[model samples]
Target chain A: MPLVDRVLLGPGPCNPYPEATLALAAPLLGHLDPEFLRILDETCDRLRTVWGTTNRRTLPLSGTGSIGMEAAFVNTVRPGTVVVVGVNGLFGVRMCEVASRYGAEVVRVDHEWGAPIDIRRMLDAHPKPDLVAAVHAETSTGVLSDIGGLAQAVHARDDNALVIADCVTSIAGMPLHIDEWGVDIAYAGTQKCLGVAPGLAPFTFSERAWARRVERPSTWYLDLGLIGDYVSGGAGGGRTYHHTAPTAMIASLHAGLGRILEEGLPAVHARHQAAGAQLQDGLAELGLKLFAADGHRLPQLTTVWVPEGVDSATIRTRLLRDFDIEIGAGAGEYATRVWRIGLMGPNATPARPALILAALRSLLG
Target chain B: MPLVDRVLLGPGPCNPYPEATLALAAPLLGHLDPEFLRILDETCDRLRTVWGTTNRRTLPLSGTGSIGMEAAFVNTVRPGTVVVVGVNGLFGVRMCEVASRYGAEVVRVDHEWGAPIDIRRMLDAHPKPDLVAAVHAETSTGVLSDIGGLAQAVHARDDNALVIADCVTSIAGMPLHIDEWGVDIAYAGTQKCLGVAPGLAPFTFSERAWARRVERPSTWYLDLGLIGDYVSGGAGGGRTYHHTAPTAMIASLHAGLGRILEEGLPAVHARHQAAGAQLQDGLAELGLKLFAADGHRLPQLTTVWVPEGVDSATIRTRLLRDFDIEIGAGAGEYATRVWRIGLMGPNATPARPALILAALRSLLG
Candidate 1:
């Protein structure tokens, strides 16, 4: 296939900062190299800042956010544990699936794909779950669940139960207070809001989550207890070699996080909100209906319903081929009924709003 | 910490191609983007060529090489499945640990660290284990096991028993004939001989192994059968969607593989061999004892026994602080007795060998 520049306005794989790319190209270092450790240390320090927590277990898992979700569940819920998952979108359902795979008794709180999670009902359903999990921003449907509300509800009933949140689509572009909201564990991917390349999943755990990790059944590779020790001067002090980390990806993340700091997290969040509103306005003017409920849509991603008689694939293909603009088709139940337009990271700009509007106008008309 | 220009002479995480790094910085693309899919297709094509296999199941697993090892066991060996693993190094021990966690009835073929795997003994002891696994190059002790010999022995007894080989330290730099040697399932990392950033694990399987994948019980995340379908043409025909892929990492890998192809695989292998010899000769002149037997040493990594009363950590620290050169301390049994010097990818240069020798001579003297 011939190479062509694309305007990414999808759920993820947003445009990256040039510096982040350059950081990736910097000289390779060993995973245990002192220099690389310094980079890891700095990256973790920045991660804590972005996550709004003082959790020492903050680090990047060397996989996508789905793996992050797996890491969170595998570490938190052992066999026969009771896991309550808020299932309003695809990611929440995935969390439930992962929890069940680990032999957890999963109780999913079902809601419509584009609707916000009902925290009260989730809390009322189960007597006491071993863990409560939800997605902060559901990438599949562009719905932002009330993470703070859910965390409160989960803690009010079962203080011992962990609260895990999938922040894959929210992290640098939204208000995520891991400490303030009493979340035990949270994870985010680089490509979405972090504006780095996708490969590393930045994750953090509160002290409560860390306490549970120590007694969890061992999964050799994904063992957080072992990984924490290895990272925190355990295997003979300094960086103990666990598995080889993706150095280039981490470097890119460091650069992306640096950009985040430079722009200031609040300003970045505001920009995402502004861009999201602009895109939503444009779509509405073009007779597109927002799939997500009002006041529940994620600022980073917007899911719009595919009008009747129009094939989502054809519109997406035409957008890519004719306009060089890429948007995401709905996943799961909404596969043919929605198109997710992302205004995330570098793509969350006024220029994207205008470009997407013009392309959709020509195509829909 | 101040950044310094240092030569990486360790077990993997060696120098990467500059172009590969730049490729990593390219605009982030969605995991299922058509353009990204084309790159994934190209990456699989290149990996197949390098792995010396025409099996349709060749692709990169999304995590580090350890994940590749886990995926291999998870997909092939279900609970109660008998798996015979050769334990001569850190990675081999890790393999046993991972397999055991998955409920595999793990049988061990133990050899002393720095010793080559005894194929005859392993086969005689196991007779007909469901799976026979071995590492091609034991990174911990720099020993190169007889992979071809082991694969033959495993297949001779039970043609159905899968032969799993860990090619992490010896993919492009050494001779690995997956097809000719009858290697059913083989996994490798990019940091070693591939001359790329570390994250993705390049893996391949024989037709027989692919069949085994179908019969395996379902796993939510590491289910290769499901992943293969999503990555290859899924139920959606040409459209494929599983987890979000690391797009930039794939791009870098593509460029790295391209560089390897441009140089010719044989030529790259020859360079590694020559560099290994040069390193060994220089170390011998410095009165350093080779950890592995001369003929069994891996071409990519040379483990040298530390001299009497010389602290390996102290020497390694000095090398890093004074010479800006990085090497590895012995892991497991050789923890304080040896240092692993790597000659991998672009780092397998005469300049690195000379610099490392000079630095060691200064420190040792």
Candidate 2:
């Protein structure tokens, strides 16, 4: 295959740090090796700091964020459990789907696509759910839901019920307080805001969430209760033998998290906001309307309206074929109506915005 | 963390080729990037050749081998599906656990922990199951089950029922003909015999397996039907989009597969056989008894009885602490009775056997 270089401005698989890539090439070590355990311990420590949480269960799941979502639902919601999900975008719908698969009686508080979740409606729903789930930053519509407000509303109804949140597109790029916000469980992917290739899912849980997992589910592979026990000295001598973790992926995550700490989380968030604003301004100058409302937009991912005369697929094709740049097409209702351009982690920079605008301007004209 | 070098002779997390690790360090690419799609296509093509099948639905699931096992069960067996699992070792017991998690009525065909699955007993079981699953190479006990004969037995009872096999420790290290062996679906991990690091689970399907997947379960993530649709033009215009794949892991797998091709699969198999024999001979000279019968032992893994006075954990710890070598402790029935030694992928060589034996002799004497 010919060498193809792409300026990744899509939803995920963001540009990785050079050091992160090098870390992936480190010599292979046994998953339970003491050296590798040190890596795991350090990675978990950094994840807790990046996620703004004090939860001890913070660790990387052995699969992608989607599987992390499944693990969260499968472990917490058994058959006959009632789960209330806030559905405004793709990930919200995904949460409802996963909950229902685990036999949860799912209730959805629906909002218009590209809008923040309706917190009032969610609270006023008829039956109190056994679990409340929402997405902090919806990747598809590029909307940042009011996670604090949602968590507050859920706790008001049923304090015992777990509050699950998908931080896939947010986490390191935005403010997430698992403990302060009373979030029982939260999951994030490594690819988007973490500036690493996709593989591992960094997840954390509160004491309440841990209690729920104690009632073991039928699924053995994702039995986080068993996994947590193994990782938390249950395996004996501070070593655990769970599934063979994605070793290289974990190494990359460690490097990425180290870079995140070096840059500092607050500064990283500010950079994302600045880069997002610049891109939004450039898009506006080129006559492109933003799909998400101004105050609710995610700084890491921006969704723009697809003009009527211009085909989304055609535009995306030209961007790749001509400019060697990649962007995300809309999903669900926005399939042909919008496009998602990511300014996440290492790609959140002034140079990327200029590159995207330059290519888009020529194509639009 | 201290830089610790230990030879991995455990069940997995074995030594990976440096080229494969370098491939993992390649620049991050979007999951759907044109270049990445090209890699994905080539990976499927290469995996098809390695699996010795012409099935169009061959692909890698973005999880560990255990998750691949879950995917097979969840997709193939619905609630109340009568599934018969061969139970001769730890992996087989794991199969039953996963099947039961999906609400399958699981029946076990029992055998001694270190023995191959009995074909006649499995055939004589009354009222043949809807799905029959077996482990090709049981890692826990170093027993090689007769997949060819097991497939025949399942077919004799009910040709319509599917046959699933776990080739976790056998795939490229031994001969496996997915089509000729009449296996409907099979999954293998990269770390074991594939000479890649742990992450991706390579899977392939027969036409019958595809038909079962069409009766989609409630699962959206493990739903091969949806994944196949997205990957095979079902999402329209052949533009595949799902979760972000572990791009680096896939790249490593591509490189690992290239190495396998370079060595040639037949030669790789022969090497494993030679290495297994060498280790067995060395163990015999040390007065240690082989756990599995002579003809039924797995070439990639060997289980040996722990002598009366020596603790299995102590010896394993000594190997790691004193010799800088890693080996596995047995599981379940053989937990305190045996130890597992692996000769897999890049670690499957004459030099490793000599090193392992010398270390064991020092510890035992």
State which candidate has the highest DockQ: 2
In model 1, the clashing pairs are none
With candidate 1 superimposed using the best TM-score fit, by how many Å does residue A177's alpha carbon deviate from the native? 1.0
For B1-365, candidate 2 gives per-residue lDDT tens digits of 44566788998878897778778877777888767778888888889988999988888888888878978888887778888888998889889988887788988888888888887887766476788888999988999989988898778777977889999899898998999889999999999989898998999888888876636565567788777865555745565466778888988898899888888998999999999999998899999999997899987899999998888888888899998899988877677888889999888889999999999888899
How would the docking of model 1 be graded? medium
What TM-score would you report for chain A in candidate 2? 0.97
Two-chain complex of model 1, DockQ on C-alpha atoms against the true structure: 0.64
| TM-scores of the candidates in the order shown | 0.97, 0.96
Q: What is model 1's interface RMSD?
A: 2.1
lDDT of 1 by residue, A1-365 (tens): 45667888898888887778778877777778778778888999999999999998899988988888878887877778988899988888888888887788999889988899898888877888888889999999899888998998788777988999999999998988999999999988988888887788899988888777735443566778777766676646645668888877887788889889899998999999999999999889998899899999887899999998999999999999899889998989788899999988988889889999999899989
- Tens digits of per-residue lDDT for model 1, B1-81: 444566778887888877687677566676777788888898899998899999888998888888889888888877888
Tens digits of lDDT, candidate 2, A1-365: 54566778999978887768878887888887777878888999999998778887888998888978988888888778988899988889889888887888898888888899888888876456788889999998999998888888788777767889999999788888888888888999988988888998999988778877736575677788667765555645454555777777887899899998999999998889889999999999998899998799887899999987999999999999999889999978688889999998888888999899999999988
Q: Cα lDDT of model 1 overall?
A: 0.85
Interface RMSDs of all predictions?
2.1, 1.6
Q: Report lDDT (CA) for all predictions.
A: 0.85, 0.85
